[model samples]
Target: MSAETIVKKCVFVEAINLICILMAKCSRLCRGNIYSLLKMSKGSSSRERG
Candidate 1:
């Protein structure tokens, strides 16, 4: 392929990689928030029962 075409392909691949990285980071953050909320609720419920 021509140099221009090669550069375009490299940019496209980089964009895809960046998007995947962002998505993975967002999922991890959401998982952490959910886990913390669950733990808080469990603790409150146990306290009420006791």
Candidate 2:
């Protein structure tokens, strides 16, 4: 392949890798937030019942 095509492929690969990393991080953060919210709600409900 030509040098230009090789460079383009490298850039595309790098972009995909970055996007994957970002998505993974965002999903983890969202999961953690949801878990915390659920815990808080459950605690409050139990406290109200008591």
Candidate 3:
């Protein structure tokens, strides 16, 4: 089929795939942020230069 004649279901599937990709990235980013905060709050602010 020509690009212009694609059906609506295919378009909807593409949209869902795009959203899933974005959501996965967002989830990873949030996890990283939470991990950093957790590490920081656990009292390892800085290592002494002994």
Best-performing candidate as measured by lDDT: 2
lDDT of 1 by residue, 1-50 (tens): 89999999999999999999999999899999999999999999999999
User: How do the predictions measure up, each by TM-score?
Assistant: 0.59, 0.66, 0.64
Candidate 1 accuracy as lDDT: 0.98
Best by TM-score: 2
- Ranking the candidates on lDDT from highest down gives 2, 1, 3
What C-alpha lDDT, on a 0 to 100 scale, does residue 33 get in candidate 3? Answer: 99
Question: What lDDT score goes with residue 3 in model 1?
Answer: 100
Model 2 lDDT tens row, 1-50: 99999999999999999999999999999999999999999999999999
**Model 3 / residue 33 / CA error / Å:** 0.5
Off-target runs (Cα >4 Å) in candidate 2 are 40-50
In model 2, where is the ten-residue run with the lowest total lDDT? 22-31
Q: What is the lDDT of candidate 3?
A: 0.84
Off by over 4 Å in 1: 36-50
lDDT winner, 1 or 2:
2
When sorted by TM-score, best at the front, the candidate numbers are 2, 3, 1
What's the lDDT for all of these models? 0.98, 0.99, 0.84
